[model samples]
Target chain A: MKAYLKKYGIRLLIVVFLVVGILAVGRSVRDGGAGLLSNVSGAIRTPFQKVATAVVSRMEELYGYVYKYDNLVQENERLRAQLADLENQIRANDQAMEENARLRELLNLQQKHTDYTFESAKVVSWNASNWDSSFTISKGSDSGLEKGDSVVTEYGVLVGTITEVGTSWSTVETVVDLDTNIGVLVGNEQVSGILEGDYTLMRSQYMKLSFVAETGQIITGDIVITSGAGGAYPQGLILGTVSSVHTEAAGQVEYAVVEPFTKLDELTQIFVIKDYQVVE
Target chain B: MFADVIDFKKLRLALVYILCLAVMMFFQDTVFARLGLFGVKMLFIPAACVAVSLFEGGFRGGLFGLLAGLLCDLSFPESTFLFTLLFPAIGFISGLAAEFWISHSFTAYMATAGFALLVTALCQMVRVIIVEPGSALTCLLTALVQTLWSLPMAAVSYTVIKRISRWGNKR
Candidate 1:
């Protein structure tokens, strides 16, 4: 019994220490893996990493043209790979810079619109189909967002409305989606109609303002804004501008093509107006 | 000291697979996801698994499929076990196809990959139908696009594995 205890006691002690060590490592890694990793690594290896990076860059540079004359194929391959990597980096950096600028503009808008209570969210994944139009956002009901909330760009351009809200994600159905229709006023005169998403018009990145009076004076370049009828949307949010005025060749109602202020394809981050004054 | 000169053929094979999967995952998420064509990004994980199955045979194919599927599950967590289950089965079937009827060549690899990818896409389409019924048509399009995009990847993966095997043989 004593021999068994002696052997097992030491083994148990070692096992306990091993488990403790593993747990410590795991805890640290879990805590510091993201966000803190770059900063911490920079603080520790900034000088060394820079030198190492420079040396590797120079080596790659040398490797590219090592046998420019004799091994042209190899050289081309290396250069092409290097170019692709650099281009990818440039794109990522460009996206980051653009997002930063957008956030700044959003902050400015937040300050300007004091009555607008807002939550910001990043556009994450897009729906796979070209027919339907909705994109997922990173923030959702947990961020006080609900279905039917008004979403806008930094320039106060109405992008879409939140249609579905989950705990951590939400879906925004854009103006070009076939299901969307907003009550809108045309030009400075407030000529009222419904700005509707037409499948045909959406292909050209435009929506249709339908049900205009057959005699209503509408022209090209006329600004369109939300009418905010029935308290569905806040008043006077910019919908778009009139691109062209037309009446269906066989139909009675006049309609104008509206070019949306927000380019739905180039979106990344958007603001959800949670609460706003219901100006009728 | 004599045993120190032990065989490392299996180790070398494992290393090749690990390296291949790592590079594929990086391209799948970081690079290809950013390269939006028609607002849809290509999926590299299925292509990678298919290539692995064609080259490595049934057991290794299944193993690699498990890894690939696990990574996929991390991003799209809705159906946690769907990819994990589907990928391994596809990989195993691909290995059978490779062993029986096909030679270890780029052309064979491309054909086998196309078959495996089509099967996987069909599975995904089915899943989408059951889960999000409204998106089924779009999912079919997505699956086809994913398969089409994966053809070139099969060529690349075959070349890479072939080179690695040649290097292994040389040593």
Candidate 2:
């Protein structure tokens, strides 16, 4: 028995370890909490990720400068030509006025939600999984950022929510992630539905507003906002605009595709709403 | 006393390999994470594990795989142990294959890496399929695309690990 055990002990141990790992992972998933190992791993990787993010940003800037020099020159010449035209001044002034108004609207985001407390964080690194849409941010529990904090743009566009938190880092699961589901009201009629991240729509950076009643009036370009039905999310957070509506093959149910106002790929900084008055 | 118990040569090789692993992970999380191809991102760590396992034998390879998988799980959002369990097994099997059946060649490495990637993709798909049953076809397609895209990592990992292994073998 000892001889046989010696020969196959490593393999037996591997099997036992795998079984234990499976059970532990299942429990962790059920509890929705990461264990100590994950936290330690996050701690170890955060500094490296920060450094890498800084280096990548610098490299991108350098690459942009080197590659876009000719485009910049062409743009400069066109701008100079436009400076000589009378129509250009009026168009430029109009654009400037629109931009000023937009800036004011963005600034009002803070005033608009006086009950909400905000903490800003920079993206350190994105998740490497092709199946997930999440990124690690610079602040975590150390900054009083909790697991369910809603992340948003300065213009009050819903980005996502914090899914996991470490001491100094947290993972923000973007709205396009397959696991995201937020209660949303669609259109000016405010047809209530669940904004769910669909696997097919996620590829195109869109989500599905499912569970809509067939009689609901939802048209293309209709704005969608948080319904705040269960008080999990804050009310009136602008999620996106309805891009399209569809019906099930059974023709009994309807859904809509929403394109988010926030350009997720362009986000470098975002704000976390740690505490918000959830008005239903 | 510690030197008597541990081979300094192997320790040097292990440290260098860890450094290489860190660099690969850095690039995987930072650069490859953003470079989407047909809606799926590239994953290189599984292939890297295969390459290291092929050269390093079972014990070291399995240890490296465990480390790599832990890091991968850390980088994945809300993922606890998917890679942590899969990668060590991949490393052990690949190492055993290398010791008994396969040659330490690029073709052999690619074959093992391809199998490892397919297994990894399938495991990832299982969760999606369970949660979003309506998107089974989408998940399958994504799994295939992810596997195809990550195949190139085999060549990269093989070239890098082979050179490092050769360097470590020198007296």
Candidate 3:
């Protein structure tokens, strides 16, 4: 036993040290491990992983089906009622046509004012962790969306920005994210301030509007728009409405809370703003 | 008949290992997930480490560790491959440590568990150094939480491994 222990002891130590050293070196490199090792590991693991993933996915699908059955029934009933209402509205078609024309004109006006080009993308997946407010969009390099591109909804409300862009998928760090900041202008007043996320709440609760002079003409209910200050976002896009204002004792500088217009949690579709001319 | 017995043994062991791995992964996905207070995830690594230490030895243990780490890495989509390498290294080192520094005593098992916890803590530190050097304090706090949580998991894994090894030897 002693001889066996003595023989293998140093060998085991060497192996441990070698692995630790390799890992440390691997950490420095962008790729964790070399090609063959990673590829082999990936290949060997993929099938088993896939099986496990499939099992979990199927279980989740079943759970979702069962859980949403009641909601589905409710939604179906609601939709049927709405469908009947729409049918009745179609019978009295003149008013419906007028309303559609009015909506088309408003949409056209919105399009004319906002020269920003949009690429529509679907939200494919969301991070399971509620604390990390990020989601993956289907659009990527192939769709002409790149990192640092601003994302918004059809109503032109700020959604988030593309932080990491892969070939087929990209991650959007929403306005709710603690690290996010947007340069915004308040309504027709043109009162500019920086909008930032609050980490503590874990929601898009309030934005910290900073660097506005205390003497600057600022008031509650001012509509905040993208100033195109930082070149990350385009000019004249609606961000939110100012909810509250904060004043320092010195009265030289002030801040305001801007409630974002986008209902971030319920977002299913978003437009990646593709072509914003940088001011700088 | 002899070859059949050998095949049966190998198949049984493989199945047992897979089942253990599945259980570990489920706990990691659910329980450690909830424990992510202030970026600190509870230590699931030690469970894999302890299991590897007791049931598997040498290259096999290392491989199992690598496998466990890879599975854990899939949960974090952002940092794609970094965790894959770091965690396997922890497992391999912990298993190696168990093989070398300690004898097969209750104390040794406890010591192995402690070593696994230390390894997990060190791995978190290494991650902090590589990924987010600025967030060392946060990582350190998280490491401490992970280490604390790993003790009981390691003990349980030790028991499971012991039982599995006994069952393996019987056939």
Q: Which candidate is the best by lDDT?
A: 2
The superposed Cα distance between candidate 1 and the true structure at residue A237, in angstroms, equals: 2.9
Off by over 4 Å in 2: A1-106, A248-253
Q: Please, what are the lDDT tens digits per residue for candidate 1 over residues A1-280?
A: 9999899998999999998887688768788564455568778898998999999999988887674655888778899999999999999999889878888887888788778998888888655333446678999989999999999987788988888888999888888776678988888667889988765555456898988855567788999998989888888889889998886676544778899987887888888999998875
Clashing pairs in 1: none
- Pick by TM-score: 1 or 3, better one: 3
lDDT of each residue in A1-280, candidate 2, tens digit only = 9889877997899999998998687776869766666679999999999999999999999999989998999999998887778587788798678656655655698788899888878888778786778888999999999998999887889999999999999999999989999998888788888999888788778998888856678889999999888887889999999998886697644788899999887787788989988675
lDDT of each: 0.77, 0.86, 0.69
Give the Cα error of residue B158 in candidate 3, in Å. 10
TM-score of chain B of 1: 0.85
User: Which candidate, 2 or 3, has the higher TM-score?
Assistant: 2
Q: How do all the candidates rank in terms of lDDT, highest first?
A: 2, 1, 3
Worst 10 residues of 2 chain A by lDDT: A98-107
Output the lDDT of residue A77, model 1.
89
Q: What lDDT is reached at residue A10 by model 1?
A: 89
Q: Provide per-model DockQ scores.
A: 0.03, 0.45, 0.04
- Chain B structural similarity (TM-score) per candidate: 0.85, 0.95, 0.77
lDDT of 2 at A185: 86
Ranking by TM-score: 2, 3, 1
